[model samples]
Target: YGIAVDSGSSGSRIQIYSWPDPSEVSKEDTSQWNSVPRVFQQEDWSYKTSPGVSTFADKPHKVWDDHYEDLIEYAEKIIPKEQWNETPIFILATAGMRLVPKKKRDTLLETICEKVGKKSEFLLENCAEQVQIIDGETEGLYGWISLNYLLGQMDDYDVSSEESNDSLRPSYGFMDMGGASTQISFVPYSREEIVKHRDDISTVYLRNVGGGVQQWDVFVSTWLGFGANEARKRYLKNLINILPELNNSNDEDDFNTKAVNDPCLPRGAKLDFLHLKHSYEIIGSGDYESCLKTTYPLLLKNLPCTETPCLFNGVHAPEIDFQRDKFVGISEYWYTANDVFHMGGEYNFLQFNEKVKSFCESDWSEIQKNSEQGAYNNVPTSILIDACFKANWVINVLHEGFNLPRVGIEEKHSTSEEADLEYKPHIPFQSAGSIKGAELSWTLGRILLYASSMIASSDKISVGIAPASKENKPFVYGGIDNPSLSSQLGHGSWSFLLLFVFLGALTLAYLYMYKRDSLKRFPTIFTQITSKLKAKYNHYRYLKLSTQEQTDLESG
Candidate 1:
């Protein structure tokens, strides 16, 4: 049995898979034979706090707890009672747990486990083991495997194969961006780079490699601050601000008399102008008025019209003008979906560009300074740009580094040379060293497939999780041998050897210096005696030479 759990910022899903005959099934089949039941959804709330402070009006903690309980209840209801006992189950958890503190996450997990354990008792005489929280990287790999491998979306790439079934093993890289964080993982056909290199070279030399098959090298993720719901709210609020009719008040005191007065309208001639005013007032009072009033003014400012035309086919001239203004308000409402949460189509791109411009022009020095303290906050512009950049980067790396052909490359270009020549390079995708979101996921998926292939027949599998980047550390698990712990021991031994060597050298140098100083300070007695004897002999020789010189002079 296999269970894959995908928890995004907004929601969570639990899937259970049962494999009937392992020999007949492909690796991709394992990922697909699962059922998903959504577990949790984020709650929305509002509040008025102290002067500038904002807090959720509704209790989010309680809402989440209840949601989790409901998910457990749903799972219990769906799964068969007989299937609850002694089934080898795998549970993978991702983004949601990462958002909360470790302690809180543990508590939440324990709570869910307890609830599930209790429910399992009714189904089975003896309940199976409690649910295990899969590591983030593992969960990401599972997602990648399910999406690309099981879905057969990335079938072009060569993966491992089962000898018995002649079925291709699936490889994938996963890039997941949740509400609070992003994770990227690469699952390859093998962890041994040299082996993979040799295999690739041999395949290439033999011309065994097929066209359209491409290896994936990297997977990456970037966390943009705005969630879907938050994006929606921002878009809605912006829409409301541009609508004019929604802002119109029924009170006559609110309008300027001079502005409304027109020389064309007969003075003291009771006309249907009041009716237009009443209609406007009615729209302003309605629930949709908020959206209309906020969007209308901006629409009018941008509309390309030499003169305001008759808004309706047969209405009073004043009423036509009023209705035209109202139509502007209605036009703004049409943008509600695009403005709030998603960036799509031509208009969204234009709006996104404007937002980017505004953000670039705004002062962010304070935020930069406080970034380490987690005080740097993002608005819609930054978030959308970040997501787009990350997404583009992933796409670019997949095409370039991995030799993965772009989906539309052939259709767009008649030949390979033409495709390569005509491809307009994007800045984000051009960089080979940097991997973001989807690219990171792709890399991770490939790595997982590689690891799985290595231990395909083994009872246990060991996987090394690569660090996110050079700046962070990688997590490793399911190891029969812990290399990190051994590495620490090796470091300590080297440090001890260096310490003794340094001290011994220092002591030998000190002893040599002491002996040299002693030799300089005190001369040996034998040397002093020799020096005196030599001086005496020199004196005797001089005397004898003087006497000999006198005798020789006399003889001469």
Candidate 2:
């Protein structure tokens, strides 16, 4: 069993996989290795929590209790107590962590590693070593590995020096969109460095589990602040940057009266917006042509390309071979299409543009009315109101930024060198987050690659049971044979003994909280209990006052 946590910008997801034992799977037959081990993907339990890990920065010490510790508690219960010593757990912080300052990020990492690693209920072999912030290239690489793994591209297909035609697997490109960033990864046919930015191309080499060496040369890149939500913020920020007058002038009588015209929104639209501690009223220009003109500048596609071709924002990406290479768009790509655009599954760019135009033409009042009438019941009003802008962003990003073939793999390039190129658009995108009813996410690929690398490196797998000192802790792979309880309790006594100490600390914490809560209620309870005594004291004083008044009346 293994646990993978995706600590994303907006939320965190916990996934537990019952990974197959490597010894049980056959290495000779490629078919024997299930696309995803049935037990692993099928029975996986997943849960999520709000306000991602970054939110805990102010209370840095509470980071573990807020999410990480609670998550591990659930995982400990799910796995049998005996197996707790062998389970491998890893958490990969994404863009959210990337945004944090280095000092804070380091502190957060140190806190979690020390607290969680030193005291864990399950087998978290080298916990401190395993958990950390993953870079953009690593994130993109694993996401690519995961999508291709599901697509069955990892299989070894060779027959002595022949039968190559019958033994080929379709490799895929992966595109993941999040709130704070976006990732793109693919295995290009050409080995030569194609991307203008060398950092965009990442390589991972592994020997297939079915018995042959395999190499994956993947092109992956991440654009920070280009995700759906962040892009919207940037789009607004760009308007402010270009038009300073919008910020300078506002109604003198009213503080919140700043308003500006926006081409991207529907005609007759007026809405209040907040950006960088300033406010603005964005009135809709309702001009689709002008909106496209405005959006192109926001993408900055024409930024003096250092390479032959450039995607928006001067980012150098390899040629996107939409015809031959298959791609999967995830996260916001799926959500916006499924919920806002109302295109549930697969859709072409043309269909996307059409829907975006129709939406942009609709007035805000009509959109709100539709939302109120259960047309988009589950979607929030804020999303419904800005649906048109978001849809346009997704479509434009896919089309212009990625250069996805608009209509069936551009026939004009069919006769040229580009056509003769490896990309032949056979299988387009199967836009997905799952295969065979199992959830698909980047963590799966991360775990699989890590295991594969470990397996490839070791000739004779050894579970170092000797009690490792804090300085040189033994490396423990994912779920494998663990020492007997008595053996670990005494043999690996450092961690095992520390576990009891951790439990003792927990008990003390509970007692402290109990006493504190009791003390909190004592004042209220005492106030209620002494209420009659205080009332009697007030009555005696009132009687004395009445007698004094009677004596005065007699004198009169």
Candidate 3:
């Protein structure tokens, strides 16, 4: 079993995962190893709480007391007490920690490691490495691995052998849109493409439990300030910049009260926009076409291309063949499509455009009326107001920015229209919050990697065992007879001798308690036990004789 805590900007979540003991079944036939051990998230084994780990920067000392204490306690309750020492807990911080100052970030993580390690029994072999902030690319790669693994698209054919058949499953592209940043990661179709984008490519070596290491070369990149919320901020700032009169007011009182006509918002919608210590009222025009035109520039497509094939902002990326390479969008992509538009799953340009167009053009009163009627039930008002803009942003990012072509619209003019294109007439993109009832999280990928690495390294196919400490060796109770347990405990050799002495003392105590009247009051429990054993031995000898011999002995 393993625990992963996803420490994000808004909140932190913890998930407990368990798999069958591979050492129990893998030794007999290694060929069936992969099929036997399936990692599963335990039922009701996930918990989430708010106000992120980064919020403790000002008071790092109060982190455990205020933030992680309850979380750790929750995990301890769910996981068996005996297995606490073996289970590994990982606290991986994402965009929230990235935004914090480096010194503060390091200090915060150090506090977490020091407190959680010393307090919690969960395995913390290398506290420094295990509890830390992960870079954007690493996060994206993890998401990619998670998506593929969950979709059952990663294990079609073994990529370990050089002479293996060419039936390996093609990995899907992954896109994650958060509030602060967005990420893209996928395995390139060709080795040439992978090599060409050497700077952007990351090789993930997955060691198969059955045998061998499967290497995956994935291209991953992250754009800061490209996420939906940040993009909206920039768009609003641009609105203020375009209208010079809005900035002309020198009086603080006047500056606090200004209004701008916003094309992106719904008609008659009003938003109290605040930027750089100034406040303004935004009046909506509800023009979807104008909004699309204006928001397209936020992608920064006009930047000078340092690399020939740039995705956006002069970043190099492999050309995506939408027909051949399928993709999945998560986070905001799922929320925007599923919540407001009521259109999730396979991306359809026509349906999406029509829905978004009507939504954006819809009057604010009408939208509110629909919400009151429970049309947008469970969807937050903040999200409802911005759904129109987010939908347009998704369209722009996919078609205008990533150049993912619209389904059946302009295939002939698509940059990916090669002469040998495998013309599959289907939308290649999918937006999903989850698949197979498991939440799509990068933490799963992290744990999977950790488990695989541990299994691959161990002679005994066990994971979650703590690494051996140089100063004080671990103590295994079962001794030499239970080699697997000893190995699992990572115990030192001296533990066996101690185990025997402990058992001997226990046996003596038991005998003394059983035959208190017959045994003499000895200084040590061992002497009393020895006397009791001798008396029992003599009685056993008398009882073993034949009936005639027994009668003759009684007469004597």
Candidate 4:
């Protein structure tokens, strides 16, 4: 059993997974348990609060005193008391943590660790150290892995070699929108596209039958400050600066007294606009068409893009083969479409534009009233205020921003061949927080990686198999392909320790085995060997402890 905590921008979620023990299970063994319950035996628990934990990061003391303690107390109630000691709980902060400074982040982590260490023996060993922010690429890759795995894409691992098998392989791309960043990841149509751009791939090694490893090539990219909330800021800033009416002020008095006409906002609605220490009164012109045009520049396709086919602001992304590729949009993507559009279970991409338009043109009084009926009453004013901008932003980002044609909610034709399927102008987007009763997020992918890492430890694979399990140790920051970055992030000591232990152990083993042979040549050989081993082992132990202490001090 493993516990994964996804600390998102809006809220934090806890996912519990109980899979058959890795020591006894394999790919074939999973078939026997498919009919019993949820996929891989998983359940989710979550808590919602204002402004995420990162918002209180500067006040590190507050996190454990309130938020972290409440979270753990809740876990104590739902999780079995006896199993708590053995259950490995991993807390991974996403984009929100990225907004915080490195020093503050480390300080926040230490406070979390300190609290966990004092908790009852319901958590696994080293639970405190397990809490930290995950890099954007890993978040993207894991999200991709979760989506594909849940969709039955990863299960068809046997699809190899044949060109026809490409259709059977994991093909759906993943797009996740959070508060501080957005991620895009998928497998390209061919190796040529990836070979030329090696930096984009996150190499993952999966444990196969009979102690084998399967290497998968996944292309992933993360755009920081491109999420819905952040994008709103950028969108409004650009719109204000570009429109002559908004920026016509030459004197301080004119700027303060003058009200700018803004079409994205509703008529007679007034907003206190602030950006880059500048302030203004923005009045609504209430034009949805003009709103759409204004939001297009936020995509920044106008940037000096010379290298890769960029989505926006010179970010390098592969030109998506929209006709052939399928994607699942999560986070804010699901929120706006599901909550606002009232398209809960399934919806089409084409319908998104129409519904959002109606929403944009609607009066503020009517918009607020929707929140009062049934499930709408609890909606926050801040979220409601930017409905037009956010909806328009999502639509443009999907179509004009990325050049992706409408695709959603896949409907299958019983006998249609992969190549024979028709390509319509608008494809229905299959959006849901959960698929087949199992929740969708990067938690499953973290489980996949965690499970494989355990399996790798037991398998007699190549020399590099150990690196695959490195993520299992929370202390091991960054991926193997990025050694320098990993070291800078504080995983260098592990590599040093591994080398010292390997050389020291090897020397001791050789000396013990050669004792009799050496005795014939020199009487003092054993004494000499013991002295050297003692010195080396003592030095290694001291260094290991010193490194751990230093790390603790710095983080604390």
Candidate 5:
């Protein structure tokens, strides 16, 4: 029995697979016992500012201790003691923990391990359960492989026919963007001749783009002055800015009415808004419009621009003037001058097309000169259109240009004609209708199965897997292809440690100054007491004078 635990940015799941003898088990029997189950559920876990910032004076663990406790309890309940002890569990954690400081991460791991260790020995007598945190690159490859297996794309090879088989081998790539970071990878097929026997199949390359959270953080920070959490908030606020006003007087009623009436907006777009609202409310008392004002400019400036005037109405208004004399030093409000002009005017496809044409035709020197002089006012829609074009290009390259194998018969023969040659193509497998948005999921599943098969046979695949067993030390594997901008951010345990320490010191200094100011204004307890006594004495004198005046009036 083997257990695979995949912990991603959003959630975590556990799968149990029972390896059985092929001769004894039928396909139906194999499928029944080897099924995956989701044993634990928790709120999507990711790194953000921790409550410990004020108390600890450094970045602290972002994961709640209760989450680990719940995980352990869930595992204990689902996995039998004996089976848990004996089964080799491959635990993989993806985006969430990668962003946190090393000290915080180490503390979290220790706490989790301690909790697991405290479990009753009777519950896990024979089985040894071990946890390993997988690196970003490894996770990317695993996801890639898993998606391929689930998609049924990996089984496309035509091994039966010799001539067509060579041309039918599959090669593909993947690009995945999550809330925190993005990854891009490439995989190529390879075959090798066995020394004494026949041959084996394997991958030639598995290269990953960015996996480090720091890189993503820095990319956003240098450009946007904030991280993913902040950028997402600004993006949503911009959306709300464009939303048509509702007739309702109550704000909550207005929001509900708009949401129900305009159901055509993408679900992700809604989620982005919800997440932004929640985060903003939790961190500050500012209204949605004010938050947008604070965040929108940074998002626009940081957004990648191979060409000029990258615009997204969902995040920024087109009228922003990054080059204005008053705005020159304000990095927070900067945006591509072109996007500002386009989004500020009427939103139409034709207007966007004309803007792009102007940009493409204009000389670079002239464009720069106009920008500096604050003369350029046209908004270009090319940036958003370009993003769509890029996504389509990737789809085409992977689906058609890549050498994916096709599983179909090349020829048909009839017994009556002495099995005479007739050329025809027949589908070898039945189509099981395509899933709408599960293409990535299918690809990831396929790659895992392929890698497992290769590893089982000791094949020399380009992608290497560190032994899942605890006896072997964890090792690095895979390469970076088409590196994401985030990958350029520096990441190291020492660097994180230094950053935390510096933050801690700065926090301590601020606290000390605050305390000193308070003390200087209030003084000590003795001085406070003396001041109170003097004020009481003056009040007593006033009361005595009033009593004397009353006595004089009685005598008269």
Candidate 6:
């Protein structure tokens, strides 16, 4: 069992995972259980709370007092009391903490580490690394591991490859679009790609069946300003920048005073844009096609390419062979498609474009009516209003910017004999919010990796077995991963001494009782016994030497 707290931008989500300990059940059936901890899930294993950990950067102490205390307490209740000392807790902060100032972020993490280490019973030997902010690349890689593990893709380990098996069923690429940033991670097929984009690659070590190690070189990259909300902010700013040109006015005051027409929003929707305390009203034009054109450039596709192949914003990315490499998208990808359009599973560009176009072209009154009447599944008006923009943004980023082939529109560029399948009405991308009733999250990946690594490195695989069992000592309570020999010996010596004194006291009491009872029953029996003793002693005294000789013989 393990716990991971995913400190994301919006809130902290605590995920508790329990698995059959590989060390315990796996000895007899190695084939049935791999080194990968087969995590079992329950409905009540996770919880989420709001305002994010980064919000407490200024008051770091409050992070424990208000944020993590309840979470830790809940974890204590969920996990068994005996397992508390061994169950590890990891607090991994994501994009939210990355945005905080360095000093504040450090302070927040320090406070978290101090609190968790001192107050919690979790096994935390390295608090600095366990409770800390993780970079975006690691976040994406963990997400990739999570998606593939949940889908059973990582279970097929090839024995022929010692380090890694690229020939096996390839791991799916992961795409996560959060509020402040977006991440893309996958295992590149060719070694040339790995060497070419070495800086963008990170190696994740996992345990294979029979306690072998598998090292994977995953390509992970993060775009800081490409998330939906951040893209919208940039698009609004771009509109403000071009406002004066539209009015053909050279004066700054005129630009500040004028209103801007935004094509991304539905018709009749009005929003206030604040720029340096100057409020400018934006009216919707409700032009779906215009929104597509405008949002496409916001990806910054024309930025100077330092490398041969650049995706967007001067970022280098290996060419994705859509025929072989499958992809799964979460967060914004799932929400934007599932919430409004009600589309999921395989990616169908034609159907998706139609849905987005229809949703975007709808009037604000119709959209609002849909929201009020629970037509959009009770989605908030604030989020529903931007559905048009988010849909267009996802389309532009995936199809135009990332160069993901739009089914029925773009060539797949595959050389396989069955290459014709690449153009078959749908791409290899999948959008999912959860799988098998469990929330698909990177926290699961972290716990899986951690469990595998710990098992691989441990000398004693069986956890509950005492190390001192070889010495014929009884297994002590608590864990015996490391026991103090001095303490054990000290306790043993006192126990033996107490037992000796107890036996002596018992013998004296028994003798006294027997003599009293014998005297009461037959007083003459003592006289006869004494006479026999004196006769035997006299015979010994005549046959033996003095008492000093006897003492010397006894000493010798």
Model number with the top lDDT: 6
- lDDT against the true structure, each candidate: 0.30, 0.61, 0.70, 0.61, 0.31, 0.71
TM-score: which is higher, 1 or 4?
4
Better of 5 and 6 by TM-score: 6
Each candidate structure's TM-score, on Cα atoms with residue i matched to residue i, is: 0.34, 0.71, 0.75, 0.74, 0.35, 0.75
Q: Per-residue alpha-carbon lDDT of model 2 for 23-52, expressed as tens digits? A: 455453457432333236545478787778
Judging by lDDT, tell me the better candidate of 5 and 6.
6
- Residue 79 lDDT, candidate 2, scale 0-100: 82
Candidate 4 or 6, higher lDDT? Answer: 6
Q: Lowest-lDDT window of 10 residues in candidate 2? A: 547-556
How well is each residue in 157-188 modelled by candidate 4, as lDDT tens digits? Answer: 43234244433244567778887788877777
2 versus 5: better lDDT goes to = 2
Candidate 6 — which residues are off by over 4 angstroms? 33-35, 161-168, 195-200, 245-258, 408-426, 457-556
Q: Kindly list the per-residue Cα lDDT of model 6 for residues 331-442, writing each as its tens digit.
A: 8998887778777555678888998888888899998988888677688888888899999999998888778887743433333211111112235686777765567888
Which regions of candidate 5 are displaced past 4 Å?
A: 10-65, 117-133, 156-168, 171-173, 188-556
**Per-model root-mean-square deviation over C-alphas:** 30.1, 18.1, 16.9, 10.4, 26.7, 19.6
- Greater lDDT among 3 and 6 belongs to 6
Residue-level lDDT for 207 in candidate 1:
6
- As a whole number from 0 to 100, the lDDT of residue 21 in candidate 5 is 33
Where does candidate 4 clash, by residue pair? 84-122, 371-376, 371-377, 408-427, 408-428, 408-429, 409-428, 409-429, 409-430
